[model samples]
Target: MKKVMLIDCCVRGVHSRTLMLAHRWLAEQERDSQVEHLRLYQLNLAPLSAQEVEQRKDTALGEQFAQADEIVVAAPYWDLSFPSILKVYLEHICIAGTTFHYVEDQAVGLCRAKRLVYVSTAGGYVGQRHLGEEYVQTLCQTLFGIPDFVGIRCEGLDLPGNDPEQLVAMVRFG
Candidate 1:
């Protein structure tokens, strides 16, 4: 069975439509696998300080990320990107010589996950404004060695003249 790590960054908890979509999608993924749900809201993850960066201490967080066969991130789209807490988690895991390393002026990924799925929701359209999603996708491939990246975004949740519930329900993760 594949080991799945579900990183939930839904700041609004159960009220987050993005998280609702993520859970729905995960439920559909042939459930003969181990799934670990990590709620970022409940974690007291500290930002990477200058001392931490200089120290480059190995972390168990990096090991967890590297060992997962599938990594799913459910982070709500805010300010043209995902929440800041998710970034903090990334700061802790994306470590040098741990999650990745440099070799002869090139970077090599150490993570073992084969796929990365990103889920988000926004009140406005997030087509061209998906800067954060793009960054994460790129990082997954270059920094983490994840080849497949799927991004599912539900927009217009709070927009006028749009049925938020219908939009969410209409989306069938493929």
Candidate 2:
């Protein structure tokens, strides 16, 4: 059985558009695989402090995240980027000799997960602007080295005539 790590960073709980889509995505995956959902908003995850970073050489957070075979991160775009909570979670996971390591001048990933799925919703169009899906994609590929990364984005959510349920259908089945 494959272990999937589901990181839900929706602060709005059930009202979150990204989480709605993510729930459906996870349901589809659950039909075919084993999943362990970890809601970042619900977790008591602490931000990496100066002391934590300095003594992270002995931390176990990275090893915990590395145990997953597939990872699904659901985050909303806030102020053209992900929420601060997700940022803190990333810092905790991106530990040396864990999720990533330094090989000479380059940083490499040590996570066993071969693929990463990023799900997000933005208030406005972020397709070409600095506030869109590209930033998340770049983080997954460049920073995290998750080569197999895919994104499902629904922009302009603040606009009218945008049926979230329909969008969920498209994201889940399309």
Candidate 3:
């Protein structure tokens, strides 16, 4: 059986739009794949200071992050980007020689997971011209070597009187 790591960074718990979308996507996946939900809002995660970054050059944290078979990150868009907590979590997960390794002028991903999906929602019109998906896709591809990357965004949610069914449809099709 395979493992799926669901990283949920929403503080709204079940009420979060991103979480709702993630659960919807999970329903489309195989049943036997074990799901491990890691909620960032509940974790005692901290940004890696300069000293920690130095020490992370040799640590077990890298090995821990490399163990996931599949990765799904969910977070609501904040200030034109992901939440700060998600960024902190990413720093911890993306370790040198663990999630990625640097070679001669290039970097390679070391994780066993072949695919990764980023689920997000925006309160307002971020515009289709924005690289919200591309930003996340590129990061995963470049740092984790996840050749298969997908980004799903549900935007314009802050508008007055949005339809619930329509929101679900957008997320499902996303």
Number of the predicted model whose lDDT against the real structure is largest = 1
What would the TM-score be for candidate 3 when compared with the true structure? 0.88
Model 1 lDDT per residue over 1-174, tens place: 999999999878888888889888888898698999989889888898899989868888888988898999998888898889988999999888888899888778888888899988889887765987898998987887788999888888989999887888888776
Error of 3 at 6 (Å): 0.6
lDDT of 2 by residue, 52-104 (tens): 87787634556767778888888888888788888788778777777777889
Question: Cα deviation of 43 in candidate 1 (Å)?
Answer: 1.2
Measured with C-alpha atoms, the lDDT of residue 121 in candidate 3 is 84
Query: What's the CA error at residue 40 for candidate 3, in Å?
Result: 0.7
List per-candidate RMSD values in Å.
1.3, 2.3, 2.1
Query: What is candidate 1's local distance difference test score?
Result: 0.87
The 0-to-1 C-alpha lDDT of every candidate, in the order given, reads 0.87, 0.76, 0.79
Top candidate by TM-score = 1
Error of 3 at 28 (Å): 1.4
